[model samples]
Target: MSATTAPASEIQPLPPAENARATRETASSAAPAAIRHYLSLPFAAVLAGIARYDSVSFWPVAILVVQILLAFLCDRHIRAHERMEPKRWAIRYALLSAAAGASWGAVVVLWFVAAPPANEALFVLACIGVSAMEFIARCRFPYGYAAHAALSLGPLVVLLLLQAAPSSFALAAVCICVSGSLILFGDTIANLIAESDKLRHDNIQLIAKLSNETREALQARDAAEASARAKSTFIANISHEIRTPLNAMLGMSQLLDRADLEKPNRDYVKVMLEAGRGLRTLLDDVITLARDDTMTDNHNDSDPALAARAVAQLLQPHAWEKQLRLSVNAPSTLPRVAADPRRVRQVLLKLTENALKFTDHGGVEITVGVDEPDDDIPAVHFSVSDTGLGIPPDAAETLFEPFMPGDASYARRHQGAGLGLAVAKRVVESLGGNIGFKSEPGEGSTFWFTLPVANASLSGATDDSDADAEVTPPSDLTLLIHTGKLRVDLALSRILESFGNRVIFAESRADAAARAARETFDVIIAGTSDAEMLAATPGMRAPLLAVLFPNDRSPASGEQILHWPAPPRTVYAAIRDAAIRKEPAAAQTRDSQEVAPIDASAFAALEKSLGLSTLLEILQSYIKTAENLCENLAEASAAGEWDEAGRVAQDIAGAASGLGLAALTATARGFAQNVRNHEVEDAHTLRNQAQLIVGEHARTRLALASLYPDLAA
Candidate 1:
């Protein structure tokens, strides 16, 4: 007889208890459909037995009716108690199936023994059909199918053999063969079903495991982002807190330098100033590290040669202090590169600073050139080579990691937090560039990086030979600057005095007007608040260069204006331009209909100076201020209060300029100009007034959402 169970190797075996439960469940669920086939068979057999009443007696009919009742009862029991006490339930199911087979076997035997030789073949055929039905119904359970086949065919084969006739013996032989074949086929079917179920279980487990892993990965990513945000916030707040006192110290040091003190005391103050500046530089490096990757994409076309020259100029004093020759070798006509000028300057500054710090005797050289073409994208290459102590072999791998200096010994001569190279690497990579170095121990190190050219065609279009040329204010020019802020006064006095110009401070608009009337000054510098009043003063002939603050108004006339906190060189250039221009340039007009919502260059400048968190705070403040000013402007305009409207418009313009909202700034400036000139009654000026109010709200919202998405949310 075929084995009652599948081979163990053919399918992974479940635990004994689970195997039993699975078998019972599969059998129970299959029982309803399996029993349906037998249900009709028992009723049909009873009808056949009645038609052959002479040969098959009432006993056969009674047996068929009993089989029908047993089928219903077994189905009901299987359905009601599926998977309950699986081991006992499976045994009971097999026994019931076997009993049903035996009942059919008894019917077949009784009919065959009573019938004549001619009808004996009919009974044998009936026995074979019932045995086939048994195989079909119970094949999924090998033990059940085997028991059913053995009991149903066993009695028929024996009775035929006992007849002692040729036809009866042949019939017995056929019954034995059919029983063996059914048992073999049923075993194969059972093995296949078992394999299918095992595969299903494995797949379910695999899917569950994968789902859990994916969920964990997402959680880890979110956690990492949150931690990064928190770190950035902490660094920005601390940097801002430190800068306030640091600035005061540096400013005091500058004040001390101007005081009449002993030589030793002067040297002491100088050292204090240098130390303070160094600390401030380290704080800036930390802030740079805290800035997010989004800064990389906020760049405009920049001149590498110009940036290189600028870095050299800024570091010239340090190089002089160290007695090292600092030089820049860059072509004046190099193509503009796709990088932020300030960030480019920062990377160069870090690299050059490191080179200067390490090298004591020899000089540092900066070289800029076009790198070899890479995939048809031209790139500008910049390198800072120094004759410093080259990197040790052991430190090469971690040289660019933060705080990992080339020489980490406590007694190492170099002094730094070792964050310069790390900051430089980050800035370069963020701009989609590669930075690396070549060093030889005890010889020198050459650090290099590449930035993509913004436009290949503009390679030879720019000439920057004069970029580093000093702008000398006309010799011994008398300049009058009107300002109340000490910081501004000190800064301007230093720059103007450095160029050998006489600077006169004005306490108020009236004082500035009186100074201009009496002094015959070459250039008059005053805040925008006093620009208009001073210009209207009788006998005032000096060109008025209006110094604009964030909350200051642009003069209605074609007066020169300079943004506050400008580079000293920029201030010099502006002064030179103002002195030479024979006439006030017609007020430069912009397309009133078109302007960018945010000036990317200006926004980047703000972010670099203020840090992201502080910049966002300023933006939030500006949004609130702009909204209120817009409301005030509308009210004043409706009341036909031109002076009040003009003041509000100027406030709006200043606030817009501070946040780099170009569209809002232009609209508000035009409205302010219109109000100042008493043109508010005209359609054009009224339209500009409406635009200023509407554009302020729209532009500020856009700036808030784009620059600081977290706060916008």
Candidate 2:
């Protein structure tokens, strides 16, 4: 017989991915077989070869035992396949396969060398069984299977053919046919393993893609939030800028009574004061609602009776000013409802103020009572009605739009930002209530709301309402002195000084003017009786708030004028309201409603948690990172990395908003959205807008500095 070497291409290697899958399958599939080979191979060899008791039989038994040990080692490696890194794994695996296949071949070759011709049947049977298994389990990678099959069967096939006999040749033919069948069958399994691994790879890529997309979406959302925050910050600053001079004008007009001014001059000052106050209201309206509504804290439980009383008391002043009767009708035993007290009061005051603002005659009435029970929770009802010209149908639908004031172009005359009703509607809905109105064109209009009382109890239940905190002035308030020939200056100084305020007196009018030019004063004490003198002086802009008084009831035109022997209540009110803007009307709008240097109280808890030093460090780090992110975003945009820019913007906005830097957050939010959506030109424009908005000394940044002073340094 002629011999031929099999080419390297006889076995098509498995793909890299398929090899891994085959390794794992090998571990699990080889486990039971491993136990069988480890136990049975040596046992079978010893039992079968012992009767012969020859060197050949002994060597066959030894090789069989070694093959069993190799099978056990391969089982251990396969079991730990997951723990092993794929690097060099294929090479290690191939070596193990060659060793395992050669071990089996050595035992088969031993059979011919050691056993007598009578045991040839045993060799044939062993060769057939071993070749079948190599094809079955190891077939996923044809290399391992082919190695085992050739090694196990090659010796037996050669020996059978070398006999030169008919029966031996026929047996060899059967063996060849069986080997071919196994090899052909192994090819099919190798393809299946490759396909399975390919699917797994595709699934892994899909999962990674989804994770990336989700992350991008989160970043876009955060950026949008920054834009919102930026908007709030910008509006707050703009409001402060607008009201600075307007407050000065109002202060001047309020001083007209004691300034010893002429009647026409007094009237002119009164008109100026009114117009200034209206302007301040517009600013307040914008600033008050500029923040995210969800971010604003709201108390959602209060008594309707108390709310009615507060609103009626607040609006009664307006009613008196208009010479219209104001009435409140509330039940003696009304229950408390789940609702925001401030929002409820705001809604009632807004309705009442609108009623008085429009009414020329008659009166306004506010009523609070329990409405008919439509549900188990019951409802607390409130109504504000006025005998004013009713709302026209054309105007009714739009009355709840922000900045939508009723007809002033017609015979109607009123001043207000159209946010009250809109805000009222929102508050009502938030409290799980419904608000509506009924009006007759010539008669009157009644605005009413019904709120759920699920958590409410009758008036007899113990009230858990917290008393309002008392307001007190801090020690050593700085005051500017402006006095000329009046005993009241000394008395006023003593009163203020007793309350822990430091007073610096100007020796002369010349000195006072010089002091005013250089220093900012919380309040100014002026005891001059000259209206003409003050009318010519330029009013301070959010610097020195003047409180002037005179010798008698004569007009003294100063910033905040009071008659001689000024009432304590009058003096206190002047001081308290000095910094506050006059709301559009006598509406009991938010007190301390000036652009207050951020309520640092908001940071008290945070400071306590992180420690002031740690909090400051985090904030400083955040600012630096945010600035870098902004720059990188711009570069990414230039490079057309919109997704990357969006991600960065999202990060910037999230950090800024977390720091309560609304302006930066709002700006970043919008810019990020534009970037994510691939609005290239719009995104670039928005990025510029954000940079302009969040520059150094930006209002939001300034406010943040107030919160963390060390951050500025």
Predicted model with the maximum lDDT: 1
Across 69-104, the per-residue lDDT of candidate 2 in tens digits comes to 777776777776756665455556667777777777
> Tens-digit lDDT track for model 1 on 1-713?
12235463454434435544666767665677776877777555654454434333555667777677777777887787784786787678788878877887777767666665665666576667767876766666666767777877888888888888898898888888888876755545655665565666779999999999999999999999999888877775576567656765676675565555676887788788778877877777778877664265554667786677667756754565565766667754578888877778889989998899889877899999999986888899999999988888888899898878888762145557778888988888888899999999889899999998885444334333223222323336788888657677777787567435788888777788888887787788888878888878888888888887655677786778887655454577678667755355344355544656765554554454334676666566556656777887777777766666665665565555434465676677677656544555775567556655676567658766876686575
* Global fold similarity of model 1 (TM-score): 0.57
Residue range with the least summed lDDT across 10 consecutive positions in model 2: 466-475
Residue range with the least summed lDDT across 10 consecutive positions in model 1 = 463-472
Off by over 4 Å in 2: 1-106, 109-192, 213-245, 257-267, 293-295, 298-301, 320-325, 358-363, 372-375, 387-399, 404-413, 429-444, 452-713
The alpha-carbon deviation from the true structure for residue 173 of candidate 2, after best TM-score superposition, in angstroms, is 13
The segments of candidate 1 whose C-alpha lies over 4 angstroms from its true place after superposition are 1-22, 25-87, 99-141, 150-196, 333-336, 373-378, 408-414, 453-455, 462-713
